[model samples]
Target: MWWFWTLWAVVALTHCSAMDRNKDKALKLMKQTPLIDGHNDLPWQIRKQFNNQLSKVDLNTIQTTHTNIPKIKEGHLAAQFWSAYVPCDTQHKDAVRQTLDQIDIIHRMCDAYPESFMFATSSQDIMEAFIQNKTASLIGVEGGHSIDSSLGILRIMYRLGVRYLTLTHSCNTPWVDNWKVDTGTEAPVHNGLSPFGKQVIKEMNRLGMLIDLAHVSEKVMNQVLDLSKAPVIFSHSSAYSLCQHKRNVPDAVLKRVRDKAGIVMVNFYNDYVTCSQTANLSQVADHFDHIKKVAGHTVIGFGSDYDGVRRVPKGLEDVSKFPDLVAELLRRGWNDTEVRGALGENLLRVLKDVERVRDSLTKDQPDDVPIPYEQVENACRTNYGYFPLDNTGHSASQSPLVLALATLLCWFFGGSSYSCRP
Candidate 1:
């Protein structure tokens, strides 16, 4: 019994020593590099719990379930892409308005707390904000339904400071299939990218928006990789090779990400990472390890999806626990370069590359393809101010007096490269 007690003391002291060493390493790394989280849904949380009102509560004093000013500061989050998330329930009804509302609140949050947060639209902006000792807040439209099949809306969103677009959520958009292609009972409508979907990819590339592949289907994943000229990002996804979840990125796609010079910011959702309602810090690290093994060290980053999901892995319960996760990684033998790359450098590199692609395409023709007439008409809440009519005021038809504007739109933009179905 005495020997057992002495052994326990030694084991406990060793554990504490290891934890302290890792924590120090994590702190040192975060201080030196900009730790940019690929996705956070604090805006969605504010919209839901606070009715999009910042005046009612102070992020400085009030504590949220997963995120807050103190937790963010403790976590050493230099930048975050606040997700403009609208539920799939709003797909055809009010997705656009809801997304805008979410984005508005995100802006309001940044404006409300200028001391802690600043609006950033580019990689350089993020670095500048970090140097100023502020968190760089960027916007990401979570689901394509927000676009309502209008490429015009997408462009307008980019001008509004939205930097990335998650091609789909849990449900399918008119243009792209979602992860449900593997999990749903129904057959896929497009199988992969519809004609309009291709235009979306092209337009996003032109706008320098990061093509986020998190919630898209496997086929859509491949199609996007094939179509997008810029390096893509799985804004909040993990390696499917470990979990076999449809929501996770498959190894085939990870290889494509590697070849395309993309990044996968590993998600901390329990079901995606552990396939269970519970997981620990080690389980999350396992994902980073697996992704690093398959996609290499540079392709890995963190997207905790904080405040977006109800359940998360244990030990990574809040935004403040990021350092703990880093510590675990360090304990598992991750060197400084590898750790720094995963922390923020890799994402910064991807952002710069995306901007480069945009610069390179400055002289190129912009995408002309509009969303197919039927797709928008069926899904959008309103069709006012849509495409104009023919000279004879005739609707879309195979008429000789000039086919419907829809037909003309398809012909004008789709050409032979797109199916342009109405």
Candidate 2:
């Protein structure tokens, strides 16, 4: 009995020592390299809190339920893209105006807390902000539809500091189809992009705005990948091979992104990361592991769709939980360099590429013309065999055995899908 107790004590001490080593390593990584989250809806969250009136709030005293200056500092977020998102609705007659409002809020926040935050358009700006001990405030338009299908508006948006534009949101635009709607039970309206949509991508390439393919259809994603002269960003997405969500990118897509030297900012949305519809922390970490296996370290970064997401993972309940994720990654055997890339350096590289592309484009270049709706309607009918299968024998539309089984299960259960509780 004495020998057994002694053996147990030695094992426990070894385990504790290992845990301490991991904790120290994680803390060092966090301190050395700060995290850069690609997308967060803090502007919209502010809009909601201030009663759709940004001017009324005392920027210094502003308190938010989700994200704020104090919370961001506490969370150790070095850089973030304050997403200018507008909901898809005909009722919101001027979507562009609403988006501008959100942008104004971000600008106000930066101006109000100059010591704490700085507006960053270039990778250099981000590095500068870090050196100054300030959080970098970057901007991204969440939907292409927010521009009201005007090239002039898009240029103006870029001028106003929008770095990236998510080509589509939850709804299909006149040019591109959203992956969610197109892949759903409803028939696809446009196969990928109308001729106009292709032009939009080219214009984005020329303008230096990183053409984001986060919410676009797989066909649209392919089209943009072919059309973009510069690297693109899936600002907030994950690996679909792991979670099997329309919102997540498939392994083939990730491979193409890697080949282009682009960045796939791994989204922290629970549904996108996990098989479970409800939020689960360990499952979220599993997605990071899976994405790394497929995309490699260079292409991976963080894109936590914070306020925009319905449910966050258990460990990552709020911005403050970011340290826990860093710790978890360290526990999983990620070295400091790997952790730094996942945090922000990878994103900085993509940002620099976008700035270079923007500088190369000429202002006098011809604007992209919109393709006629009739032409788009005609093309979808003729486009067949566009959905190519992967090595696993799964096309973009549906996977082979797993999807087939899911379909049968839904049918057997009277069209009710399984829902796992959090």
Candidate 3:
């Protein structure tokens, strides 16, 4: 009996020690790989809090905000895609201007803290920032409204270092219907995506801009996946099968993304993750489980939505709590490689793919020609006329995907002298 009791006590102690070691190992791995968060709304948070005035907020020290330089360091965040989110209420032209302002502020923030931050546009830039002990800052424009239906504006945005663009916000764009605003409403104006909307995807691919599907309808998500030659991303969304939130990705879409070789960066908003008024870090991990089950580990990444949402998962209330989530994942039997993929490697791969697609299209003429207003209106009037997946009913000659591919072929044969550059 004494021997049995002693053996049981030894087993309990060993398990406890193993947990502590795992937690420590998780932190060490984060330091080595450095998390590349897919989205953070600190830029918009600064806009609302300090009126885009960095002087009012001291990021070097901890403030009332969810993110700060110190907290971000503690969390071992190596790179962040800061969201330049304009509200859905902002009118079209104002939304575009405000988005530019939001992006400018992000640049200013990086400049203001040179030692702590560096603006990064490519995966190599992110690695360089990490090696130099600075946080790699990338900008993401959060809504299609920011381009105001102008492809030229989109080009300028990418040139200005905007690496990704969310196709919609909380409201429908003229070319796309948002998930939140279109759900349960009258049939969406565009069943899935308008003719011009498909052009948006093509242009993004040509420009190397990541097409983020965080707020668009499921139909739009599917259409983009079918049309995109490069990888796509969900900058900040969760699994809808788990939360039932319209903002979350459905399982079917997750599988399609896996087929496209894209990634879905999980959101940390409690409501989106758990579909509950109350939530915790475990709830966040449950979302990871569902996404991984549907899409596999290579398609998973983190998009905390920090500073964008009011309530966060309990143990992940702030940027500093990122390591806590990593520790929890490690404890749940995730190995180092899987955890690293979720932290940053998956997103890096997506970025590299986008870059490769852009390089492939460099010889093609730029898609600067805007859709004429009559054509735009005609497409909108014929919204539900054709299935987005099988648009053979529409003239094959008018198909954007066909035109885009044709242009690529022409470029390959040295047939294009016209440059549609911005």
TM-score of each: 0.90, 0.82, 0.85
The candidate 3 region of ten consecutive residues with least summed lDDT is 378-387
- Of the two candidates 1 and 2, the one with more favorable TM-score, higher being better, is 1
Q: Which digits, one per residue and each the tens of the lDDT, describe model 2 over residues 43-91?
A: 8777666755667766445555557667787788889998999888721
- Please report the candidate that would top TM-score against the real structure: 1
lDDT computed for candidate 2: 0.78
Cα lDDT of model 3 by residue, 11-68, tens digit: 9999989778877988899888869898898888888888998887889874867899
State each model's CA lDDT, in order: 0.88, 0.78, 0.86
Clashing pairs for model 2 are none
Query: Where does model 2 exceed 4 Å of error?
Result: 1-17, 55-64, 90-92, 363-422
| Model 1 TM-score on a 0 to 1 scale | 0.90
Steric collisions counted per model: 1, 0, 0
Could you tell me which residue pairs clash in candidate 3? Answer: none
- Model 1: CA > 4 A from native: 1-4, 379-422
